[model samples]
Target: MEIKEVKQRKEIIEPLLEVWQKSVRSTHHFLNEKEIVMISQYVPSAFENIPHFIVGYDEQKPIAFMGIDGERIEMLFIDPICQGQGIEKN
Candidate 1:
């Protein structure tokens, strides 16, 4: 697996959105379908506003992503299948 910064946020928004939704659903059991859909509406804009964006790839396929603002991590979502694989620590 390789983790790299994404210069163009657009390049990873769609794939990361899929990762974000899948991850949220799998882990955020308190959220309902409607709530998830509502929150998803803002995901792309959030990506746009993030100062630093990075993605993790496995075999050149997107598997995880993070959005950083200054020294804080604003967002992080890993594909459900890929979680617990040490990608976050990497």
Candidate 2:
């Protein structure tokens, strides 16, 4: 496994969005269907504005990602299949 900085936001946007949606659906049950849809509409633009992004990979497959803006973490997501593997800890 390895962690690498993401230099191109567009390159992984699709997979990143997939991971984000799956993660949110599994974890953020407080959000109603309408809120989920609204947030979904905004995620892409938010992703575009993140200044720092990194991805965790197992071999060549991306398993998790985190986005940072200065000191605050804007996003962190793991592929549901890869959850509980402690990818977030490292």
Candidate 3:
């Protein structure tokens, strides 16, 4: 797996959303659609002057993603299939 900073909500959101929703539903048994949409809409601005939005990929496919909000981590999600691989620690 490789990690990089992602810009452009339009480019990163769909993959992030897919992984996030799947992971959440499988693990937490709940769907936070409104929160997900808010995050999708807020991520770009959330990183306006910050470093990269950490995104993890495997075999060129997006596998995990995280957003930084100031000094805190606002969101993190890895593909449900990839959970035990320590992708989130990246």
Steric clashes per prediction: 0, 0, 0
Candidate 1 lDDT tens digits, 1-90: 989988788876788899899999999999999999999999999988888988899887889999899999998999999988788999
List residue ranges in candidate 1 displaced over 4 A: none
lDDT score for residue 78 of model 3: 79
lDDT tens digits by residue: candidate 3, 13-81: 566667776777667645476765665565455545445578789988888877786788877777889
lDDT of 3: 0.71
Which pairs clash in the backbone of model 1?
none
The local lDDT score (0 to 100) that residue 42 gets in candidate 1 is 97
Poorly placed runs, candidate 3 (over 4 Å):
30-52
Query: How well does candidate 3 score on lDDT at residue 39?
Result: 52
Q: Among these predicted structures, which one has the highest TM-score?
A: 1
Clashes of 2: 0
> For residues 1-90, could you state the per-residue lDDT of candidate 2 as single tens digits?
899898777877777778788888888999987888788888877778889888888877777888899999988888888889777888
Give RMSD to native, each candidate. Answer: 1.0, 1.6, 3.5
- Give the candidate number with the greatest lDDT: 1
Alpha-carbon lDDT, every model = 0.90, 0.83, 0.71
Better of 2 and 3 by lDDT: 2
